[model samples]
Target: MKKIYLWFTENYLSIIVPLILLLIWESCSRFNLIETKFLPSPSWIIREFFILLSNGELVRNLLISIIRVAEGFFIGVSLGIIVGIQVALNKNLQKSVRFIFGILRPIPVIAWIPVLILWLGIDESSKIAAISIGSFWSVLVSVVQAIRNVDKKYLEVAKVLRKDYKTTMLDVILPSTLPEIFTGIRIGIDVAWRSVIAAELIAASAGIGYMIMYARELFQIDIVLVGVFSIGLTGIVIEELVKVAERHLLRWNTNIYQEEVTRKI
Candidate 1:
């Protein structure tokens, strides 16, 4: 009970502040203290939300957005991990690829929208491409850094045991670098989600982004707000899932790290 109380206390501000702001907004709108044109009341938004929910439009659009994000994120993370590992293992490869990545990494994902549309015809392919490009660099950089930062002592011990490169990498390097790789994957998913939404806003016929864009076009502020809130909520849920996955996969490392911290203390 005490632990539960402490947890609630720690998280009270995060929960209370949002609730307070929402209540204030709803109150102001209900009392006509604020113009409904620009700021729709929570009740009005809730009604519209129910309407969209009943009609299944919201779910449909949400599913489409989720599908695009999943497709793009998986592809980007896979390629990024492979490339990152390769570069980290080979000094020559790292040097050769550095110039290209340096130039491409700084370009905003939205900047590719026009070119992708032209090349891929404003279809799912273009949107996926945009998301992939947006997420790849961040994941690649994170994985590379994680691999590079792996403790050299592990490699030395593996070598002393006559472990081959593949064995060493599988047992030592991959495990040691997993936490960093997972962090990168978390960030990559965020970038992919944002990039996919932007792409969908520009060209998609069915997606949360499309719904938001359509709402904006029809001057339905409530629908727009619903879409915004939906995005934020979805992002938070996905991030939590990633954290759960990280915990499961890195359980061993977590114990080791905790023990080391205990020793230090």
Candidate 2:
């Protein structure tokens, strides 16, 4: 009981508010405060979710969306990192490419879907294209900023040690910018997921966004709610996974201060 209490205390932000909202929603449904036709209770939504799952509709759509995101994220992040490093290290390249990015970056990912669809057709390729484009800019900008933010002192130290250009970049610049790169990755993944959903909503026959849109057209509000809930829950899980990976990869930097304190103790 004590452990349960402690766990609740630790996770209150993630738990208590959602529980309260669920209870309020359930109460509203019970009291007929809202028309069930428009807004079903949380319990009804949960039941619909299970029904969809058992029929494999939810799982199939979810898998399709995940695959699209994974493909786009991998491609976008790789290109972003490579291009960001190249541009950051070369002043002439940065200046040459600045205008192109300035014009492109402000455009919303959804706006690109029509163009992408025309180029790649209303298929997985089009969806992936939209996701990649949306995610790429986010990651590129972050990586450039992170590289630029690297300490001058570190550069000087590297020079003092007579490190070659390759060594300096790999050891000093790369390591110093890892935290910000990971931040970019997190942001990029979010952009990728959102773009994929928008693409699916626009054209694809299978995805969480498609599920929600189809349910809405059929006036199955509970199923729409289930799709929304599933999307939100999946996003949370993915973001948490990214955070865990970030912590693991950057553990040397994150734990250095803690290690020093421990030694003192």
Candidate 3:
């Protein structure tokens, strides 16, 4: 009993809350405290989840959503990093583009849905474009800010070492700005991921967003809950993957405590 308690204490985060919630949910459903049709029990939802999985519909839609997010996120982050770095390094370019970006950045992501639909039509292109736009500005702003805020002392040291522009940027500026850039990328991806539902809602025939919409229309709350759970769970997994990659790639920049934590894991 003591060993079991110790094990649970060590792994509390991964277990306790979920276990409590599941117990409460199951009890409520068993007692009919809540309408089963509207809010199915965890067991029923799990059953529906397995049914969808076995039929392959869930996997197919998940893959579609993942593909859309990847395409849009890649484009947005690539362009954002390149443009932000160029503008930050060149005073003249910064002056030329700052006002334009300032004017354009305030427009909300959803506002582009209509225009994208008109330009690209009600297809994958439009959806991808919307997600890309949603991610781009956030990443651009973060990259530009990170680069701009780099320590002048570091630049001076690089100058003293006779580092060329390319060398200075590659060895000094980029390394210093990496943490912020990673943060930006994470935020941008999150925005892009969330925007998938809205983008697909425009006219998508497949994807998690479409599945949720269809389930809602059919009043299949169990399926709807499954879709919502999938979205949140997928998002968490993606974010953790990005963080792990970042930790591996930028291990030198990580704090000592974080490094120790990683080692323990």
Candidate 4:
């Protein structure tokens, strides 16, 4: 009980500050101290949220956005991991691709929107392409770095044990790089989600971004706020889920790091 209380005390500022600000905003809006037209009260936003919920409009748009993200994320991560491993293992491949990747990687994902719209039209394909483009370079770079940074001593030991390259890569190198690769995956998901939203805002007929855009056109600030908050809340929920998976999957790493820290202490 004491430990739990101490933990809450340590973390109280995070929760309390946000809560206080939200309360103040709600109060100001309700009292007309701040124009509700621009910044609606929390209650107005909640009411608008329920109105959208009852109409099923929010669900449909959210589903479309989620589908685009999933499709792009899976395909991008697959190609990134495979190519990254190949490039890491083969100097020739790395040399051939590195300059091209470096040149293209710095380009912002939003910059590709016009090109994708021209090529794929303002449809699901264009949105997915935007997300894929956004995710691919980041994942590829992270994967390559993770693979290259795997302990060379482990490879030497595997060779001494007469382990085949396939076995060594799958059992030793891949496992060793799992944490970093997953970090890349998390980044990929985040980038893909943002790119998807941007794509939807620019071109798509259906998505949370589209909903917000439409609300703005009609001057319904409450609906716009609902869409904005929904996007932020969903991102946070997905990020938390990723963190939980990371903790469970990387328990071995957590234990190892904890032991090292304890030794230093």
Number of the top candidate by lDDT?
Answer: 1
Q: What's the TM for model 3?
A: 0.88
Please write out the lDDT profile of model 4 over residues 185-234, one tens digit for every residue.
88988999899889988887789999989989999999998998888888
Error of 1 at 173 (Å): 0.4
lDDT of candidate model 2 versus the reference: 0.88
Candidate 1 regions with alpha-carbon error over 4 angstroms: 1-7, 254-265
Look at candidate 4 and tell me the lDDT of residue 196: 88
Question: Residue 255 deviation, candidate 3, in Å?
Answer: 9.5
**Shift of residue 112 alpha carbon in model 4, Å:** 0.7
TM-score comparison, 3 vs 4, better candidate: 4
State, as a TM-score between 0 and 1, how close model 1 is to the true structure: 0.92
lDDT of 1 by residue, 63-170 (tens): 999999999888898889989899999999999988988898899999999999999997789999998888898889999999889778667767777888887777
Q: What TM-score would each prediction reach against the true structure?
A: 0.92, 0.92, 0.88, 0.90
Worst 10 residues of 2 by lDDT: 256-265
Candidate rank order under lDDT? 1, 2, 3, 4
| Alpha-carbon local distance difference test for all models | 0.88, 0.88, 0.87, 0.86
lDDT of 3 by residue, 18-62 (tens): 999999999999999999989999999999999999999999999
Candidate 1 residue-wise lDDT at 107: 96
Candidate 4 lowest-lDDT run of ten: 256-265
Q: What is candidate 4's local distance difference test score? A: 0.86
Better of 2 and 4 by TM-score: 2
